[model samples]
Target: MDVDIEDILAELNTDSTAVDQSGNPFSDINNNNNASTLYNESSSYPETNLKTNATSTSIPSPQQDYNNLIILWRNERCAPELLPYPHNLMTRMLSRIQEQMERLEIISMDFLGQQHSTTTTDTTGNNPVNNNNMLPLLCMEAELERIKFVIRSFIRCRLSKIDKFSLYLRQINEENESISPLQDFLSKDEMIYYESHSEILLKLFNDTILKHLPPNMQAINDNTGTVPMIDEPDWNKFVFIKVIGPQNKIFNTDPILIKGDNGKWYYEVIIPELQERVELIIDSIYVMRYKVIKDLLMEGKVTLI
Candidate 1:
């Protein structure tokens, strides 16, 4: 197509040096002469090329989209505020990445195939321009790789949270007890780890406490609190006892039971008027001496405070 000098001059607001009285930008040049002579004559005249303009107009850049994705992924990864439910967000993000990858694949295949076909048609395998076109393809490949890496990092970051807060996650999933905002997002391994770790710690604590007790003193069942007295026992002799109560039960004393924001219940006993809070509903946590809270711990009906 012939270059429209009039349209070009009008678009450029008719620069005084470029446009003459006849309205033609290059009035001095003959039609037979090359246009490069006019461009070389004046630095004020902006050079325009048909092929360069066409290529630039045809291909839309995806740089902005890539930038937006990077920012979103970074924020999602590093933000301290935890979403109440992250599974849904993960599902959405993964789906978006899959769709984007599929689209990118299609675009890359079509573009690369066209370039390859064009290059192959020329028997001379040494086309410099064809080789230069590979730069854009290389840049696209690099961008795709970057996006993929960030996405993988983002997923790993989320899984790291699941690993770090495994106990809280298990508590939420199993007992509907959300100890943290990220509690509901748990994996099977995390749940198993929490249960096993908790059981081990409780067993160790129980055994350590039991080892300090006298031989005559033993763990008495809730139904049988009366232990057989040892021979020649002094009046000061006493046994160490431990017990736990079921959930949602009232204690003998008017213990103030309060549930925390994390869904764990605490008790404040009025007898000794405890200044500190005591956790409730733990099966192995109610440790007491038989001499003090013996009768209360034996009765399964009353919850420890």
Candidate 2:
């Protein structure tokens, strides 16, 4: 996984007249005037399909996607409740992943083909390893693995949230058939997973514990009384957020109080005019209750670090 991407890419992008790692000036790969680079990142991309900016139709660079993935992974983990699935971002990223995979397969095949065609050896009496050719493949594979890891972690975080609040989501879904968090926040596959998990959990409870209880107490989601049985995400949970908005933008967040390690509560923000809300400055980090800044998070003004 230790890869130097610049060196490998630079070597592959050299002129046809230049000498290669094996000291062969005219290798089959370099013979053509317009040899295809291993990674034609800009040219290989499909049309831009981003939801972040609907009117902007230019493809974002790989670094932008990488940073967005990191932000999304953190936000999904730190937020108490599940967030909406990013359909457009995911679609573009997945398409690029598939294309990169195909490109790698082709390059790997070419490596084998070119090696077979090379019928020469140096004074060392051993076949050249072609380190220059293989380096890009190794680095690219490592980077691709990293991207897949982040994506898998993001999906797993969402699944955990769904599992933790399965009954709550189901109750809300049943109460309102038109609009619910189940329909708005969850993806189609995740909704199906929630349903399957809820059914299995209910069956397990009925077969083991619930069957022994009285009829009145047998219901799993008994929110009628003061104390509710079903669990829901706590909006009071504190999260670390950083303002990522433009210089001109400012957030007037709801007043939030935090309990310190000594069990003493204090206001993180000083009092201001209108409902005691405080101004959130740009490039500043704050620890506030999730409910207090949920709107800002939803509006893309701040990111959970």
Candidate 3:
């Protein structure tokens, strides 16, 4: 029997045929369209998965490979080579470097020692007697003597060297006490006394020797009325003096009046109202020479006697 197209269409339109066993005939058509699209995509892009796997397993680039090769070559070149027992080239190189460093340290230490020796010789006049280095020794001795003369003339006191050094140490100790833990050992009054004495000495030093003594002369004689022989007046006994004028002016060659039989010097004028008697001493003469009297003496305004 021949099938009719109209009947087949009618059967497809029926509810039982249109609906699936689970009541969804359209679901089957949608699934088939999706499968067709997926098949077409897979065919068109055949190497997609292969391309992904290849990218994941890729090796380093040419530049990176070159850099790695260079590093490997360096490692091989620097690698320690095996040597005979008890003799390693790498160890020998390290030992040589260490020896050179030691030698440099020794040279530096010797140079420092020489410098210190030179400085000490310059200051103390005790030249090192390395007969091999005679020129440096002579130079050092000459320089030291020059420095000693300058110090003696400018800074040495009429007091003994020991006394002067003691005073200096005391002054230094007092100054250090401000920052030192040894402050507890010094009494407050002692510190104050040192400071006051130091100030007075500084003023006197500035006014006298520093101001008056000729640059070339180590000793200055300040006796008036006829130059006395060295035996007549003891040079060592002379004390430093400074003569102050009104308004901070100072007098040079300040007249020193020798008292009768006492061999003492006093100021010419005694102000009973102030109960102050000015005195003239070596220091006074020195200061006066620089501050006031030099000009007057040069002008013949005043005579020393």
Candidate 4:
């Protein structure tokens, strides 16, 4: 069957640059151990660096930024764990957003100039302002606002996580008081915020009530008792995800050879472990534990809803 090239290109809604040589975002993991592969391959992207102090000034295409920001926003919103900071993606997204804003400004200025100079009347001699000229500028402004909203929400989502689990995140990195602390799941700016926020809260607590406690009992992260003082994220939280990459054979595939009552061969196997034992087809939705799918989410094999 002959297919139109334009139709195929039109179907590629996301940025094609995201797909690597194998045409899979994570280079087409073909092993049963897919989760680990997701983690290892994520570092390949210039954007998803694990180093909290790392900086990225490279900008990707606008489409790539838009799609990636949406993915980051949605996953950050739903995931129980704080996903790795997408350094390059955020850098590029903000750059492109600023560029679009400048463009809108230029378009607005031009629209005003045209309105003052090119005033026109219809056959009825009515001299109303031309909304047709404002259409393109209005559309661009709307798009810019939408992108800005997504960026703000994405950052705010991360901030909320940082605020909620500030102690937990600090514990992840700052537990090592001897070494230079680096948040494994936070960006450099976010790390600053975390430190300031945590310090202020601790100081306020101590000034208000903790100062009266005994020195030994004043420890904030007192894990010595039945309940720990430090708050932690719910790693076992359930989330909805849509598969965006290939699945491992263990999922929705048979390993055993069997015979049916009709004497026909059937490959049947049971996996009582996986919460959602289904093949990862593109766009297939499933509900599963956040920790179980966290690696896949980082690898871009799936996105949270």
TM-score leader:
2
Relative to the unseen true structure, what is the Cα RMSD of model 3?
48.1
lDDT of 2: 0.62
Per-residue accuracy of model 2 over 16-119 as CA lDDT, tens digit each: 11221111111111222222322235333333422332212334444444555567778898999888776445654676678667767777777766566564
The count of backbone overlaps in candidate 4 is 0
- Which pairs in model 4 have colliding backbones? none
User: Which predicted model would earn the best lDDT?
Assistant: 2
Ranking by lDDT: 2, 4, 1, 3
lDDT of 4 by residue, 163-200 (tens): 88877766767567555345434667888998899899
TM-score sort, best first: 2, 4, 1, 3
Assess every candidate by TM-score. 0.33, 0.70, 0.15, 0.68
- Tens digits of per-residue lDDT, candidate 1, 1-305, equal 22233443432232122211111111111121232322211213233431232221121112212332343354335333222222322333345456546644765576567567777897775677755645544554565476578767765665555444444444444554344322343334444555676567547856888567775544421223464322211212233322333222333333544556886555433224344444444233544332234333323223223
lDDT tens readout by residue for model 3, 1-305: 23233532332232112121111111111233132322211112222342232221222221222222222222222212100111111122234334434533554455457657777867854455433333433343443344334323322221222233334344444667665322232224434554576568667876877567666442222223276312221112222223322111123343443443465433443434466554443224432222233323222222232
Alpha-carbon local distance difference test for all models: 0.39, 0.62, 0.32, 0.57
Show where candidate 2 strays beyond 4 Å: 1-42, 45-63, 117-129, 246-276
- The per-prediction tally of clashing pairs is 0, 0, 7, 0
Quote the positional error of residue 190 for candidate 2 in Å: 1.2
